[model samples]
Target: MKKENLPPFKITNEILTLIYEIGELIGKISVTQEFEKNLILRRENRIKTIYSSLAIEQNTLTLEQVTDVINGKRVLAPLKDIKEVQNAYEIYERLDELNDNSVKDLLLAHKIMTSELIKENGKFRSKNAGVYQGEKLIHMGSMPAHIPELINNLFLWLKNSKEHPLIKAAVFHYEFEFIHPFQDGNGRIGRLWHTLILSKWKDFFGWLPIESLVQKYQKEYYTAINNSNRDGESTEFILFMLKIINETLIELIENQKMTDKMTDKMTDKNKKRIEVILKYLSQKNYIDNKEAQNLLDVSEATAKRFLNKLVKENILEAVGEYKARKYIKK
Candidate 1:
């Protein structure tokens, strides 16, 4: 396909300005070392991502509940909602394994995300599905008969387009939602894939928690989509997302600075990430990497890092080794 086959979007001046601002912020954020290799930050970001994405869909599970559910703890929430957090955690954890341009992978992700929740899991709708408000239909998805080719063409345009990844990712997000490929879970999966596209372009985005901001301004998010829908172009949605990306980067920078201010030393900084875990450890007989990982919704490596750091700080003692390794409060 040629450039002419690209989705209908204009590269307006506002879009270009946001792109520049985002670039500058990305540079600053990258150098600030907020998320360079910090498992704690990434873990927090992933939690925010899951919570916000689900929250936008009216999941009603609080952020704390989402974090708890991800760590394998029981949460007093609806079963379907709890399953959503579990499924999202599993999908995001495997971000490294997904190819953003692969339509097959998209279906697989939907399967993982919506299994046991929707009968249309892992497949496009064969019947017309539309966004609803109360009993009133607000927005109708594409005709079910055309979904297969629409998604393929959309992916092709995304993969081959000359636009910046930031713009392409945002445009892809709006276009994906417009197509509304799945009968359910379209909102969550669209946001996940948006993050996926950016993370592929810049690994830092794998845990940026843009959805937290999306959920914050969810009305604007939907408004942008509706505006794009009305105009028959994605420029409005593109502008909206670029602004969100810029703002997210700004928050990351500001947050790192605040984290710095909250600490007088590196150890103090480390301590802040696990105040709860340490308190929880004080009452427990033992805590292992799996338990800590669940407690923090962090990776195994991240959990080990925290535990080893604590041991060195004389706050916890390491016992056993390998799979038998555990930590006890000193």
Candidate 2:
């Protein structure tokens, strides 16, 4: 196999500053009452991440549609749009199982993410590919025969590189796009894989939802990618992504503050119950009366009261019949 050299990138003051800012925000959030305990906020951020990431790829489904689709409800969007959401949801649900340094794992994720939408779902393209803006060709991908070798080298470098995880992941994302390994779904997979890389470094990043911010600056996103391509270095792209991550962490800290103020009057007992419920919900996605009781080591009445109170406060949505009802993070 041909071994290709990894692309070069220079870290500037901007990247270092953003990293420091992100770490400071994460430090503040780590001590907050809601950092790991805010179940509802985590779920909402997840939905936003999925919707916005797909939206950047022109998936037409709205946030509500994405939520409904995730809940296994019928959505009246194009079959392609619906399938993209379903596939992405499935991939993200098992992100912990993915290996960031394995090309095979990358292909498998692409397969899961593009299932039913592309004939070559998990496989790299056998033909050339080009990224275009309307009729303008912005970037032409590496030759098809070279993709495997190029990607293999990329992962090899990632495994051996001593670079910080943040910088390494940002560089990997940029190089992945430049390679355009797959004929379809490259953009989405690049973004998704970057999160996977970061999550492996810090599990908290698994639910950080940086993609939501990326979607907000969609034009700048492409411009950064284009500029990096032009410069043949990933400095600009790294800075751009670091900014997104920094902003996302800042938003998380801000949201945690809001939660603190809103729940200032909540009793210690009630706060503990919500924390327990959030942990359970994080793992199972929903908590029924029986499961809640078992998970919390509480009686049926107590579980029901706690769950009902959360529902009343708009922290969760109560679904199903009275006896069979379950509470899902809202």
Q: Which candidate is the best by lDDT?
A: 2
Mind giving the per-residue lDDT tens digits that candidate 1 earns over 121-158?
99999999898778987789989988998899999988
Q: Candidate 1: misplaced stretches above 4 Å?
A: 1-5, 265-330
Look at candidate 1 and give me any clashing residue pairs: none
**Full-model lDDT, candidate 2:** 0.86
Question: How accurate locally is residue 69 in candidate 2, as Cα lDDT from 0 to 100?
Answer: 93
Candidate lDDT (C-alpha), each: 0.85, 0.86
lDDT of 2 by residue, 119-237 (tens): 89899999999999999999999999999888988998899999999999999999999999998999999999899999998887888889989999999999999999988899999
Error of 1 at 138 (Å): 2.3
TM-score of each: 0.80, 0.80
TM-score of 2: 0.80
